[model samples]
Target: MRREIIDYLKFLMGAPFIKGYRLIGETHLHIQYYSEFEEFKSDHPMSEYTKEEFDQYFNENDTLKKLLVGESVRLLRQFSYLECVTIEIKSYDRVVVEVHSSRFILNKYFGFNIEDLSLGDNTWKSMFVDVYLADPAKRNELYEKIVCKFNQ
Candidate 1:
């Protein structure tokens, strides 16, 4: 099932554009692409909203609806150069999607109690520092070690 989900995510590589997304409570996220939709559910057991709060917010919040739907359209417009997507699975049902082009990168995280997205430039420094290393200091440390070992 994990492999299947990963394979499905590869479809985003050349997808025309992202349509929108739906958040059902806090457990399920449904993402609509140009041609299809995919669903992702959380494996953790925790609710971000109470039943009463959820009902009230869902019925009364235009901002929430606009947030989920409008963001996709806005993102598509902003990152017209996006050509490929790379998926990093932190855990079962928890994934980070890196969408990139020659000039920019957009990272979107989905799973558990988090749904976050960030955009940055596709620079070598950014890739080496942000994507590859969790701790920025490790890059210099690793490089020094590699150079010392290679010289031996």
Candidate 2:
């Protein structure tokens, strides 16, 4: 799963930017776009998942989904404050994003159950994932779709 996630991200290496939302609460959803994303650092390095335990856990899951570009993704807001969205390459509609939070020492999981989420919670929020296509001609089409869905 770790390698699969990295590979999906790498597929966007040539993309100019990626854009998505940061849901603050029930009433607020903020747009957070990133340029120079290839240079952006991941707070929790992928190395953490290399441990034998995580490897076993990943292998045990016969249904682990693979991420892809343009598909909606869900992640646990456990490691970082930045809200993120990722596309799955394969799976039955399960997405998990983990962001590091300075407020907690232990890594936690969110989005396990949608009913468990609360609007006022600062550490967690749900969002969609979008990646700018590397081809300039195709970007406008996607941009228009994004505007219609998010910009309102």
Candidate 3:
């Protein structure tokens, strides 16, 4: 399962953004854009909105709509390179995703049923999303890879 997890994360090589969704105790974390929307690019005007207008603009804007909740802002393109992703198999199980262009570090601990690889909890899912979104390249390779793994 650990090897599977590492293999699963390899698709993060050039992801553009990551989004997370949680319902009750169930959570999902996956790459945003899914690589299918790479041809479309929308620029969001961050400086144009006031606090109230920001919400209104976000509601009406297509670009903002694509972003996950609380991710209304964008990351600079300079932070696209992936430094390394490390999995630590020890007394306790964990994984660390490190980014080369940003200070963001994602640490996830093992949850129930590693064989499933969902690893959904309050913190880990969001962290996974965070790391996924740090890169500005979009490709659904990660999603395809994971789905294929599960299918096997």
Q: TM-score of predicted model 3?
A: 0.18
What value does the lDDT take at residue 136 in candidate 3? Answer: 32
Alpha-carbon RMSD, each predicted model:
19.3, 16.5, 17.7
Expressed as tens digits, the lDDT of each residue in 1-152 for candidate 3 is 22343344444322222221111221122222221122112222333424453333223333232232212111211122222221111111111121111113211221222122233553323443343433333212222222211110
Give the local distance difference test score of model 1: 0.29
User: What is candidate 2's CA lDDT for residue 139?
Assistant: 37
* Tens-place lDDT digits, model 2, residues 1-152: 23333344333322222233444542222322232222222322442333343333223222111112222222322213323342211112222221221112212222243223334662123321222333334333433333212110
Residues 91-149, model 1: lDDT tens digits: 22343222121112223321111112224444423433243333435433322322211
Candidate 2 — worst ten consecutive residues by lDDT sum?
98-107
Better of 1 and 3 by TM-score: 1
The segments of candidate 3 whose C-alpha lies over 4 angstroms from its true place after superposition are: 1-11, 17-24, 37-40, 43-152
Name the best candidate (by lDDT): 1
Best candidate according to TM-score: 1
* Per-model TM-score versus the true fold: 0.22, 0.20, 0.18
Off by over 4 Å in 1: 1-43, 52-57, 82-152
Task: Score residue 126 of candidate 2 by CA lDDT.
Answer: 31
